[model samples]
Target: MTVFLRLSAAAVTAVASCQAVGALAQEVEPSDRATTDRLEEIVVTAARRPTTFQDADVSVTVLSRIQLEQARIRDIRQLDGVVPNVQFNESGQLGSTFISIRGIESNPFIVNRAAVYIDGIPFRELSNAVLNQVESIEVLRGPQATLYGANSESGLIVINTRAPTDHAVYEGRFTTTGFQGGTSAMIDGFAAGPLSETVSGSLAFKASTSDSFLRNIQPGRPAGEIRENFLQGRLRWKPSDALTINATAYVLDTNAPGVFDQEYLPLDVDLYNRTYAETYNGGRTIGQFTYVNDAPKKTEELETVAGLSATYQLAYGTLDAAVSYRKLSTDARGLDVELTALPTSAGQDYKVKTFWNGELRFASPADRPFNYIVGVSHYRQDDRRFLATFVGPGELDDFVPAPVQLAEARDWGAFFSANWTPTALPALTISGGLRYDRAHRSADQTAGSLDLGPAGIFVYRDASLSGDFDAVLPRASALYRVSSQFSLYANAAKGYVPGGFNLTAAQADLADQVLRYDSETLWSREAGFKWRSSNGRFRLAGAAFYIRADHWQEIQVATDEEGRLISSDYIGTDASIDSKGFEIEATAEPIDRLTLTANLGYTDARYRNLQLDADTNVSGERVKLVPEYDGYLAARYQASNGLYVRAEAALTGEESLESRGEAIQPATQTIGLQLGYEGPRWSARLFVDNLTNVRRSSGLAFRNFAFGNDGNWYAPIARSRQVGFELGVRL
Candidate 1:
């Protein structure tokens, strides 16, 4: 029995477009607030170990390192909502980092509902690193699959960088940033000390040059620029003290300008903040190349992570182990855009990628109440796709073409989790875990190829698909320490994602055939509560959830039985689905000199009978940005001499841009401002971002034309709304 239907009633309104830090802990965190202790400070890998934060029961959000040096955040999408429902999308790469937590997001070849870790490892691609050595950022909303497995089923972002610190001392800091019109320069610095009497390590570097904000009217030309660079180094060797070793190396060179996301406006014309110069002068009238990518797509990435963890000393406690390695590469230039869909020629497309990963883990030791963790993971990927279309003038055509997709993938997994607190029931704590995932993929399609001259006949075909997949993910949680500040929790979970193969060449491949998409699952349930107030400051938290998916995937609109109109691939899978949410985060200092932070979220996405095969219609569409009122609030003030001030406000309300079909973004609000001065080593500042240029829209790309009448002259829209200025220094 299959079902899925709903496309009437004015089509459910449209609009598409869609951090952690810790320390100085004492103890007495019912999750946060005027609690007494001084540094019990807390954390729980979102239900993995070293618990705190009201003993945790899911529903999480944290950011420290002085709140990322007071919001001067650089990557990690500005830590988005400070938490709550987590929302972030950056089709622009490097700046936004494509992520939508709480609301779960897949796409980028789907397969991650929310899972990204660093420190405890497991970072296959949450948009690949780049946060300049962060020290904290945790957001474990719901469905963390017992402990962040099974793609997390839509909740998890554990990033904890910045290690080797306890003294033997010397530190460093430096920063420079500016932006307007297109975008401009940026620099970063870092340093650490001590190599004797045990060991030490640290070093960082960042570089950027921006200038691309779409405004190419196709003429003599001017406007379009991009540049980026990064370098990193780290080493920690303990020789003894049980066992410890860490080595890290990083290098990223993305020449930027893959067209900076957009600048070639031809979709009729809307001149939005106009300005383009991403370079691509090959003269002559051309209609479109699938939105245009006239070459200029560059990428370079290098990563090496080495680890050796140990804590031995088990008289019944203390034991840990870890191992890791990863490598990746990307070379892009997609514009093979259907010869501008006959705009008379000109629309480019390209693809190239290489990936690798490995992991290992073990754990046990939490002062005993029974604790455990185990793991094994592996992944490999390779891709090469290219097709250029343009048929006219000075006559030169890849003579006509068809897709030439290629792929190589290998995945493996074995995970475990356990936690049981007994000893007179310290308030009840029982957690569980399970993971056994296996995936193997393959593909080959050289369907067509040619290099014809004198512009004429063209033909190519061979779309391929080779596959294999297996899955099993399960998790559980429970907590009821209803005192010492309050607590109550419950959880259950299951998740899966594994499907591959799709590489095509077009000449209408005989009407159409070349679309692959399958692999999706979800099952979740949750509950939560927490409060704090002992003397540390003030804190509060909340959570609630209910989700189910017996197969849920997207990327729709497939056709071709002579009816033509076949290009966008990836089909749908259905069955009643659900998503409920609630979050009310808080932090306060009231007087000591003013300091406060706030976050709020209310999410709900639906479509309970969109099954397939057995037509079961159910309308009431609303699930995409999963917005039912999101939130953020901040205020900082420190006084003991030098003056300082800070204020922030954020609100994201309005959502419903589902895919597998259609929907785009509309509805927004954003604001920020900062002023500061502090002296100890050195400090100075001034900042203003967005401020008002709130111009927002993000259905995150999904519009193409050329079928029934030139599809609006080829549509493309993705980035706009940026204001920047920053200065920082500390030593």
Candidate 2:
């Protein structure tokens, strides 16, 4: 309603402005249809447009599907150490796996730590990019607010999925592999064709199942199995060269039949951490889609997105209109989740649904000597959660008499930004942006669905207004074209993640003990270069960057001890955290039959200034889990005999990880080896992941509180290095 009126008015004003500007502009050539694959295009998407990997002044890694498959990257969890600056952490068993890009990454569903996107869509959930369905994955380092928005303070991991094509097509693939400690099988298919003179549609689906990787940690325990299924389709209608309309729909489902548990082992014993014990069972499902009209003059996209944006190209710049809507829900069940005085009550369910965000963007075409971007955005969300509780340990088995409590929230935000490139300075660009957010949360202990006295509600509502926040970020960079194939550039930018409330509200009776500190922000500076040969046979890129983070977010230790689902806390206010790194990659085809590629990266992340609760000043604290070095080397050999072979190796450095102030997992490195053979109609592969079985914890690392006398929480978190073999023959 009112939102629509505002958008339409702005749009009309933009059209008039564009028409007027074009009347006085200089002539320029329309870009030629790029001959190289678009996927190969150096994505400036990280910055906003197509800038060479190096020319744009950002450190990044671009992994295409071909490379991923060749490296035997099967699961999202398998990405550990595959690239530098990537460390993983998972809790709540195998099914709820969570990975961190570098350290201090955010949980999209729980906090504002990092930002994730799909296509041009800013999607918060990283798990939705069906692994097998991805066309490419791009990792962007450092602050990205000049182009992308929100929580892009630390970094961003973008997935570009396969898209609709211009020609008709049919394709399918099936694979089966035996892992040392597990079994996995998969089938995927896709088709695209014309339905009429003006329309075409594409359909894609993937299905897979894998047995648990651990053995018998618990006596008589059986292996838990995990399954994934997905179906996504798109229909596009092109009525004219200038007009295209597309509608999309998708369904993704992940069901882990049972829980994968940890076995406790004593700390002093060698090979002490090893448990293939299986436990629990549950699942979850999420679905969504969108409709878009892309015209030569303007593109209109309507999405059920976390947020939305609609922009019309204008002569001076583009004018954007936007909106957003969202809803999320989760349900997990079974027995005990962890060793605690409290057990996740049986038949008890955990859930969160109803949250949405919106934003708009406008930018001038970069072709002109001077370019700029301006936009505003908003967000609103509703989260409702409930858990079960019992009287005490003795009566716990019988279940509690009723629902323990309910948590709910309603939040709002607004933001604006602009990027300017002076007309006379063709080699320089400057950007600036700002944001303001307001959030409101309410909670209740239901006596029966509607209960919670007035005072309880007041405290919740008043506390929200008590903590409003605002931020301002500015950035600048320049690219000096050293040659047609080379360029030098440097940039400095600021990015921040919004603050959040504590999980459960504390009563005024506990006043003076209330703690409040908005989380940290990341500021980064980077420099790099780009080069390519005229023959397209050789390419190279490199970049160096440093990031400083202040007030890093963390789980509040005191809150945890007080018994809450989650606590919010910021650490090291007196000291800033710093992560410095460099990445370089080269691809050269010396001859028609041979191609070589390699990428190397190094990142050093540590705490420089850490102030723990005013008195405990722990400066120089090393951020746990982030490795200092990682890289991959690969080669592809093709023969006139119609066969191709690829060999690759990846290296990951070790790090010291601890929990509850006790050293748990030590630094270790795991290497991977892959051998593949491909021909006209057949292919086969043999992969040895964790080939060294380097004993590193795969999930959360901590001492086992439940282990029998001996103490190891993560015994078989990771396999003792394993191997997998697969073969396929086309009909």
Candidate 3:
């Protein structure tokens, strides 16, 4: 990987230098007025204050709408290796997304380690429609506890949507993507304009569907597929000069066919002879010693969100308030592959979640010598789930209902942040923030089983548990300007992940141990430098960071020496993991009609003194889901005839898949190309992604067993060698 980076740097320098000389010969000198103009300043609200990116003492990455469209990114999954130190995989069992940032991972379906927000409303899950309707995305890679509170120990993601305008605006787009075994079609449109002098509204919608990638060798089984539809609307009113009100609503509907587990022949066939087997599912044999089951699996989900925000001018500053409500429902049914006794047992589950959030804030004037912001927020969330497994005339001869669980959580927090630049030190600035959060969590679960015969129903276990937690988080930072175009900054921050009650605790005797997991703490120190050229055509940023984390909560699965399942436990490790890394990002247009961009990230995260028990000491092991290095490089060229071409390449480093370093996933690289033509009102593009046809494992479920299912895994093979065409028109 180092060699690749060196070669790429040399090639880019040589080509850009040659092009610069040739273009300079054909270009004219800038006029006096043109020379005074500079690049448009990038504004951000990372610290709850509006400021230029170059003036802030934090690390952040911003992607504009134009950049997203140029990359042909349709969903959050496409952002996998594009950014530094971020890994996102939307392909997994049961249609769940896996997110990891800076060596901290979060489960999309369960507890969260990071926070995501759209238009100031917290999003518990990433819907399929979010990426297509947002105007910009900000990735802040650090503890955001001062403002975001719990669940933001790793980082935060902010999304802003395009609002209504005073003048009428509208656009429509159509696209088609084709691959070896499947094809997809998408249609999207948006319109925004004013209905009255003081009133404006905007609307956007998208509809898309795609065929499946895996082809079932057996007949009469539908291929795994996907379908989604989304709609969003917004209204803004400014009846007075000092007051403004806004309303937003969005809805998403999605259907997806889940993992396709295939079976193969084991290396040692003799082990199967000793295994027991039985006939089930209407004369079909079911057991670890038998052939695989080819049953269909599917998932369907619906999500809706509504929010309202109001802002009013105060005598000395500004006041803002907002409230939002969100609801999500999912229904899934699939074959139970892990249960070797009943290969055809149907596993069905239903889940429903609701969330409510509100906030009130006030801020002093930005130009004041001492500026400050204070805010209070409240949140309430409830979840209900039911699951059942039907044996369907197997040896078990009964339907097992694993338990119905109800979980509820409520939290509130208050924060205060201040910034100051003393009169004696005009070129130096300091900032500090403090926050306090209190939370209450509870869970209720019931377990049961039903006999198919006249034996009747049996209830085994029922229990309830509750807990409360509170914490105080703080942050401080300083920045010094060496010159107008360069600055140095350093910061120290603290973050934590909230404790929770586990719903899987069923045994009455062990309920106390299994029902509660403690919160974890993380402390980080970072320093970096920012630089920009006087011409405003070149920009560079870099950072070095070290993090110390303790009491990390992890779910570990145990098995016997023969690889047979024993138990899965959720516990807080007594050990610690230290993480250190550096990042570099640069953008330059050394020659006219050409632009170049590159970013590199490196991380070294490992566990120290990790002793699960007196007999087990697995220290110095690499953290799961964290790669050593990742990077990307791209270049684009535009001609005077409205034609453009761009090429990009991205790489991911090798990493272990499990905590004990049992399974290893190899490194992989891919390239992309695009050709497009633009006009005043219309544009068209043809693109090819994954030109190298790389097939790395995206998700894995493996164990060393005689059955051929050990090596079976799931990957988005449909995206390989993809050919796509897009057309757009504005009105």
Please, what is the whole-model Cα lDDT of each candidate in the order they appear? 0.56, 0.50, 0.67
For residues 1-731, what per-residue lDDT tens digits would candidate 2 score against the true structure? Answer: 23433443443344334433222212111111112222244555555555555456566777766567656665555554445566555443332344455455433223534566654554554442245556677777666665566566767767656666655544445555555556666666555667788887777776666664533222223335556667777676777654455555565665554332222222333323122111221111110110010100100111232333344555566565555444444444333323221222222334555545555666667666555555555555555555433222222234333333344433344444444556686555554545453444443443332111211111221233234555666566666767777777777878766554443333322233233446467778888887878677788888888887886654432222223222212221334667888877787777765667777777777776554443554455556555556676667665555455666666665554531323445555556665566653345666666666555544434433222222433322455555666554322
For each candidate, give its TM-score against the true structure: 0.33, 0.74, 0.85
Model 3 misplaced stretches (Cα beyond 4 Å): 1-40, 91-94, 108-110, 128-130, 214-217, 257-293, 338-342, 392-401, 449-461, 505-511, 566-575, 609-615, 699-719
- Residue 530 in model 1: lDDT: 82
- As a TM-score, model 2 comes out at 0.74
lDDT string, candidate 3, 88-193, tens digits: 6443422555566777765433455667788889875554443555687777787887877677787787878878777666666777777666777777776787
Candidate 3 residue pairs that clash: none
* 10 residues in a row with least lDDT, candidate 1: 10-19
Top model number, lDDT: 3
Point out the worst 10-residue segment of candidate 3 by lDDT: 24-33
Cα misplacement distance, residue 655 of candidate 2 (Å): 2.1
Q: Report the Cα lDDT for candidate 3.
A: 0.67
RMSD versus native structure for model 3: 9.5
